[model samples]
Target: MTPELVRELIARGEALTLEFKGEERRQLSENDLVETVVCMANRPTQEMGYVLIGVEDDGRVTGARPRDAGGIDPLRIQALIANRTRPSLSCRVWVVELEGKPVLVIEVPRSCKDLCVRVRV
Candidate 1:
């Protein structure tokens, strides 16, 4: 995604379709990420959901360090979600440069089924 898109998302703030996750203290836990994806996928809006990493709930951009982003394997995250959730969740995982910092974006499409649940992670 472009920096402008990321800026727009931040401007919109948290809502049914958007959520923020900051890595201020430590790396995000797999379970937390999986569960959130499930929740967003199940939302009634049926619109695409976004999980913006390195952004705080208040819209502050803490941002992920370059090394931190390098350490996060998108393929590994995708595999984890695929194996942990019931009915599975298909998502696009990518990193964008926002203000010279890495921001991970997890885009979750609305589920065709009723809901997605996290079995384990």
Candidate 2:
């Protein structure tokens, strides 16, 4: 999915969950991300989905353009997803820049193979 698609989802208040850093920022491990995607897919009628790590859940535009935290490479996140997921779930990762903050956008395509996935990280 394109960055625009991810933005649309956020606008609709459908896809993407804002994960914070420090407070509940339980490290973006491969298993943690995978389980999140799985839970999202399992939700009733939630077909394809996206996960964004940054913004808050209350629609508080806290990020997007100016990525503050360092060392969290987008490529590494993608690799974690690709290497840990089972049955090979197709996904798209985009580094969306909004208001100078960089947000990691992970697009998960609800697969037919399995609805439940275990946390990997």
Candidate 3:
């Protein structure tokens, strides 16, 4: 997504289709990441949900930590979410530079199955 869209989402605040995770102060655990993705995917509507990392609940952009040598790996994130979530959720992952910091964005589509049963992480 574009940087402007990310900003708009943050301005709109959290909702059923949007969540913000502040990974600036404390690193977000892997389990929390997976669970958030699962929750967004399970939303009742078929609309796309977004998880914006590096953004605080109050809309502060402190930025996400680099997972690799120089940046976060989108492919790695996609694989992790797919592997951890039940029904194997597939998502689009990317990074946007805002206020001189990197924000990680995970776009989760609604689950096709009845529910994400027995999701373990």
TM-score of each candidate structure, all chains considered together? 0.86, 0.65, 0.92
**Whole-model Cα lDDT of every candidate shown, in order:** 0.80, 0.56, 0.88
Local distance difference test, candidate 3: 0.88
- Could you give the candidate ranking by TM-score, starting with the highest? 3, 1, 2
Candidate 3: tens digits of C-alpha lDDT, residues 5-119: 9999999999999999998689888788888888888888767899999999999999998876967998999998888877788899999999999999999898876665335
Q: Which stretches of candidate 2 lie over 4 Å from their true place?
A: 1-4, 15-30, 44-46, 64-72, 113-115
- Return the number of clashes found in candidate 2: 10
For residues 41-112, write the lDDT of model 1, one tens digit per residue.
887786779988899889988885333345767677777777888788778887887877778888888887
Name the lDDT value of residue 11 in candidate 3.
94
How many clashing pairs in candidate 1?
Answer: 0
> Per-residue lDDT of 47-79 in model 2, one digit per residue for the tens?
556677655575444554332366456666666
Model 1 segments more than 4 A misplaced: 65-70, 113-115
Ranked by lDDT, the better of candidates 1 and 3 is 3
Separate clash counts for every candidate: 0, 10, 0
State the RMSD for candidate 1: 2.3
